[model samples]
Target: MEALTGCTRDELIGAPFKNYFTDPERAETSIKLVLSEKKVTNYELTARARDGRETVVSYNATTFYDRDRRLQGVFAAARDVTESKRVEEEIRTLNAELTSANKELEAFSYSVSHDLRAPLRSIDGFSQAFLDDFGSTVPEEGRENLERVRRATQRMGQLIDDMLLLSRVTRREMHMQETDISALAADVTGELALDNPQRDVQLTIEPGMAATGDPQLLRIVLVNLLGNAWKFTSRRQHAHVSMGTVRDPEHGPAFFVRDDGVGFDAKYKEKLFVAFQRLHAQEEFPGTGIGLATIQRVIRRHGGDVWAEGEVDRGATFYFTIPDLHVSCPVKGKQP
Candidate 1:
């Protein structure tokens, strides 16, 4: 208190207490309030030091009485909070600046992606038209070159669409609720089967598996994981894919998508979830290399983590956990 007022004990002992504060009227009223109400806490006041330096302080006071029950006076203590207040203001300003920057970045990404799509569509359309109109006149090499142009345009269009989806993953609002993991896996696998009717794929999903999260996002997670599993297992005469949950000692209940397919090196596991990072050749697995990154973003938004375990040519398994969301189901035995 003496440091805050910049006064010696001798100089302050007989001085009027309210005179040391910038607002003498408020300071006097605070003391009267403590007398009537018995106590007051965290009453903000600006204390003017002897040298005219002002400091923001929180005053806590209580009424004191004599042993005979006669009202004596109010005793108060003030703590300097000027530095803390300054830090709080700085934090608020930084948060506002960050929010503004993110909004601008999202807008820029959307505009660029939207602009690129128009030219890509035009290129693909013109290339197809040329092949149809001048197929006999063009040499064999010229026809193949036109086909390559169309393919490149198609791939570029997919990449642009994926980039936009990735951006939306961060910007979209989440609606959390109880979602059935098994049902979502079933739906995705059914679509995969219809798309690749020739492939013989065996899919097993554990029953009654559920979690609390955005149903739409969770379905996307299944689509990407199961779709990758289905794609990579294309070479196998008989492919096996499974989905289930297991209790991880560190992460609690965890969900997984496992497949017996042409897997990747374990060393490149970290690269799998990074956008545009590919382990296999584009010819071997056709993708925009953005699926795993999208899955990571969606899982993280729900306070979860996603990881992969794989070995060359053996298989791969992806595990994700949503902590604090009651993600679990009763496993009777091993899933067939």
Candidate 2:
């Protein structure tokens, strides 16, 4: 170390070098860069001594040029960051621990699913029994009251199922593969047709679309996306819906679900992907309200993203991305 700085090797070996450093690689690389292309750049590395003491530093190396553009020895300035790096690593470890803890909590919540549903069943059964035993004696309004009790119990059961889904999504397996987006969309459309055959509406899907992701989770995402599209666009005489992709120069490619129906305001976009958040009235739209939240979670778990755009009584488009490795989605092909 001292030899490089014009000092005796023995003296440089034991000096307070932990706070001082010189990167020969930085010097060499800088020299080559200036001679070849002449640019300023920086890099980080560690320097260790014979005694095992070490220093971490980043070298911001630059080339010096004479007014006539004559070559000069590259000058390097280093910033000691051993402590900073240590703290940064500590922060990263803490964050990882926090994420794991969050997952564990979700697992714990899922475990409660078994315990939670039993009581709802008891309530529902008891309510039905009361109606059956005293139906002839009970007034019409009294029978109606029992019906409401049964309805409440069923609703609570549905809520527990929703909770389970939300937790499972947090720790679900992701298998990435090539998928045809158009095929998946077509399959969803066909199933919706069978599921709600009475409804008279047009469901149009663009062709030749593709993507890469976990097929299972992506199917859930599509089901929710298309389901919402179908639900919101129901009011229209001829529902307008499209599925395709767009190229973003800086951000690569993004796939989207476009629909003309009951669109929401831009202000609530962020809240759309949150659990149990519904922008519309329950009377107008019946949902457990966790669909979008689950869709967002699956998308994120696959290392992708999701966003939406819309306005009241206008239309909406939701754009999201997976890995773009494969694509799959066709009507008769409602995922196996």
Candidate 3:
């Protein structure tokens, strides 16, 4: 009080309480409000010093009573919030600037992808034309070089597409609802089988598995996981893949996808969810390395968590949870 009003205790003791405030009427009304409301908290006022300086103050006041239960007076405390308020405004300004910068970066990425792809398609198209027009005239090595060029172009295109998808995953507006995890897994697995009919993989989906999330995003998660499972187990004579829900001691229920495939090293599991980070050689298993990163973003947006456990050459399991939602729901039968 002495610092705010620039008055000693002796001068403050019997002076009009409102005189030290810029808005005397509001300051006086604040005490009356406490008497009626029993208490008033975080009431804002501007304290005026004797040197004509002002400071922002927050007042918390309560009504007091005498021994006979008669009204006595109001007891109030004031705190300077000038620095905290300034910091809050600064944070708001920084957040706005950050949002603008992100939008600009996203736009730049899209423009670069579009410009690069045009030339890439032209190169591939002309290379194919050359092969078609002068196939016999060109040497075998020359033809192989042309094919390599085409392959590189195709791979670059795929990388661009995947990068765009990863960007969209973070910027997309989510629509949360009760999603059927079992049905989504079944659909994704069925698609994988159709795409590679030669592979005889045993797939199991626990029936009635459900959770709350964006259904479209959740489907992408299943497609990426099940696709990886199917790809990694291509060499196994007896491959097995399954999806189910398990109760987590720390985070309620979690949904899991398990695969008896060429699992990765557990020590490097953290790399699994970082964009463009890969564990295995590109020749061994082909991928853009954006799948798990996308899955982590989706789960996090739903206020949940995702993790993995695996051992090299053994198998792997991925687990994710949606906050406060159950994964076990009753349904008719199993999906295989």
Candidate 4:
């Protein structure tokens, strides 16, 4: 058998097959893996022929014993898969092209939405101005109808704005650079302060910390995280908000926004990041529900991620990452 199959049949007669293809140290590790897998001892592998050519082989080898329960020799067989491998490479190339096309389409659709927003805003604005200025001259019930029309137009306009923003997020090119996370937080806090000067809230931002990410996108991320923190904790006795970063292996570094606000169940964390998805009633919290969805897109574009943790009436901590900005991505053309 050894002479026919080029195998040292004497060596294979009793000992384990590990002494063959893989080295001693590797064989021990491989054997442990096999034991842990608890699968049948049948697998396909590659080996070098006597002519030094590579051949794919399949073998079924197992433990054996005599009627006395004593160990016995193992037998093996094999098959080749060189043609199968050639077909697999062709399929992989096709799949890669398909993925590239899909990514291009997503980017294009986003740009188209952004470009259409300006015209929609003008139409809504002019209709409102005309209704408000000339309502007095119109008939009583007719004027009321015009006011309703104006309000409806404004609401639709806001919805369009949100949709456009969400689309632009997907298309926009992220400009990665050294970004001051604390400064972005502080700036957003200040803006929130100016927006709601009457609300006295204690906001703490850890200074001297930074992240590598696009400044503009980071602003959007900070605005959503901090703004949610501010709004949800608005009615608290003494509102508190904190911003800081934590170490991560896969994402490098992660920044988080913490607040003592009306938190939610952890079960719905995934839903919170989806577009147009909201967990709270509109009356409790006024929002387009596009914020977190946009945040998810931004983090992903930077090769990062976002997640949240909270309890009902306790508070929520939102964690997000910004990839190292120094790295450059090729401007591969994307579709609309």
Give the top-scoring candidate (TM-score).
Answer: 1
Which ten contiguous residues of candidate 4 have the minimum total lDDT? 327-336
Model 4 per-residue lDDT tens digits across residues 106-162 = 776656556666666676677667767986787888867766666666666666667
* Candidate order, lDDT descending: 1, 3, 2, 4
Which is better, 1 or 2, measured by lDDT? 1
Candidate 3 residue spans exceeding 4 A from truth: 7-43, 48-53, 59-79, 248-252, 265-267, 311-313, 329-336
Please, what is the whole-model Cα lDDT of each candidate in the order they appear? 0.88, 0.75, 0.87, 0.72
User: Which 10 successive residues of model 1 have the least lDDT summed?
Assistant: 327-336
TM-score of 4: 0.57
Error of 1 at 7 (Å): 4.0
Task: Please identify which of the two predictions, 1 or 4, would achieve the higher TM-score against the true structure.
Answer: 1
Q: Determine the backbone clash count of candidate 3.
A: 0
Q: Per-residue lDDT for 68 in model 3?
A: 98
Model 4, residue 102: C-alpha shift (Å): 9.0
Model 2 is weakest, by summed lDDT over 10 consecutive residues, at 327-336
Model 1, residue 233: displacement in angstroms? 1.2
Q: What tens-digit string does per-residue lDDT give for candidate 1 at 230-273?
A: 99988999999998887666666788899999999999999999
Inter-residue clash pairs, candidate 4: 104-335, 108-336
